[model samples]
Target: MAPIRTFIAAPSNLGLKPPAPGVAPGVRHLPEHLQQFSFASRAGAVQTIYLEPPTYHGDIDPETRMRNADAIRGYSIVLAEQVQDTVRAGRQAIVLGGDCSILLGCMLGLRSQGNYGLFFLDGHTDYMWPEHSATGGVAGMDLALVTGNGHEKLTDIHHCRPYVPEQQVFCCGNRVPDESYVQLIRQSQINYYDLDALRRFGLPATAVQFLQLVETRGLDGFWVHLDVDVLHNDLMPCVDSPQPGGLSYAELRSVLLPLLSAPACKGIDITILDPTLDPDGRYASVFVDHLTGILQDAATAVL
Candidate 1:
């Protein structure tokens, strides 16, 4: 039987620093914007689960030094519960995000089920400590937090530290050059693949290698965290942090098709696309078309 797809709406931008002082990041509107195109129906979602986040205060928490720190922690806990329920009911979850930090909740929820691997595709590495962060945005440090490298409150949720082990992680698409924190990921056990390496390795081959890592490690499943900023700036400039080099839509599809087609691939969370930036909605339309088409193709192959 084909698995039911559940659209999990996680419209929380509390993880990012305000784009302007006292102004919250506009990514909170991503879910509704995508819905304008019937994203749920087009993606074959039978049920939609919406998880509300705490209000965006745009202030750094004294305890964690990250913007809306406790709020993000609370929201993550709730999001995890929703994910656990969807998985228990034997449905595939398609998580829509307010920012990349939502990956914390998705991975935390999957941890309760069994050991899982992670395929992190983003334009930046997103690995750093709060002290190293100039803005104290969790969205930029999510990879570090998920791998159990940050504050105890966020990292040790439900006493499950390192939600997804670093060794089982495959991080790709980082194009940032000469950033100090990029070196942090390089020193970690996580398999790192930069944009240049991805092109050199070939997208299809990279996807195969990720799958092999998941299968050989005896993981129950794996989750894919795709920050749309991984798409070239010309293609997807609506992200909170747009960068220079990234995959084209065709390149993204080439890599995602194989990863999403695998039965062991549990689910994926799409994040960091800010609707406010794309006022005309043209970018959202293209993103929806490519993503839904990929989901459809993956479903067909899986069945």
Candidate 2:
């Protein structure tokens, strides 16, 4: 494998607001530290691309959600095109996101060439359909869309359904999954390691288990979607939905280290950082610090 090509696909339309007045100015940019891990910036082994988010307000109506979803899908299409072009040219892609929904486009882009496994780390299942959704927020429908279950436009992005078989998908760090969604997961063959399970199994061991499953399933490749809310809210409160009793910062690193080290892992999407929610920017800084370490380690391993 060649050096990793990092792309920060900032699709800010997920409707999270920036910090309110009187909040520190530096809070919003805390995650910028991630750029320091770029191989291009330091050792020149990692290439970085920062994508600007599309303009869309986060609203809760079906019409508004659909419209925003379309915009997000469109933006992802463009991003996927770039990702495909880069991978075709022989480079790995790492996408930093505006929200978890960006995974739809990132997956679409990767699957265009061949099948890829998915590792979804989030507080919620994000598998709720519009009808099942309590908030009717498109962000919650992200996983459902990618799995070919929601709005037609989202599922049909890139001219084909991008549902990697349920067996090929792994949902981790889910503390607040909907009951119906849990049933949906149980009915399907998808692998799920919720918060309690993660605590019992530990991140490295759990990650290894998933990797073994991927190998046994003969997956072509794998992508990781890490939502900051998967971390303990106290440590990473700058997300759209903050949950308690989540993974600790160290635990998160443990989970990601092995995945990042895996030869089959293709790309990553780090999402759900709401700067406005962080009063002191400490949360963003902490999350980014750990993320930067992972990127740096990945770049070193690949190099």
Winner by lDDT: 1
lDDT by residue (1-303, candidate 1, tens digit) is: 455789999999988988887788899999999999899999989999888889999788888888888888999999998888888788889999999889989999999999999999999888897998998999999999999999998999999998999999989999998757588999999999999999999998998998998889889989999999999999999987777878999999999999888888778999988999998899999999999999988888842
lDDT of 2: 0.67
Question: TM-scores of the models, in the given order?
Answer: 0.98, 0.85
Query: Among these predicted structures, which one has the highest TM-score?
Result: 1
C-alpha lDDT of candidate 1 relative to the true structure: 0.90
lDDT of 2 at 67: 34
lDDT of 2 by residue, 1-303 (tens): 435565554544442332344332222232453443332343233556666666555444465444366567677787777766766766666666666667777778777868778889888777767777655555677777777777676787756785566668888888875566677666656688778887787778888888998889787778888877888877776666666778887888888878877777777777777555665556655565677677677666641
Residue ranges of candidate 1 with Cα displaced over 4 Å = none
Error of 1 at 163 (Å): 0.2
> Against the correct fold, how does model 2 do in TM-score?
0.85
lDDT of 1 at 118: 93
Each candidate: RMSD:
1.1, 3.9
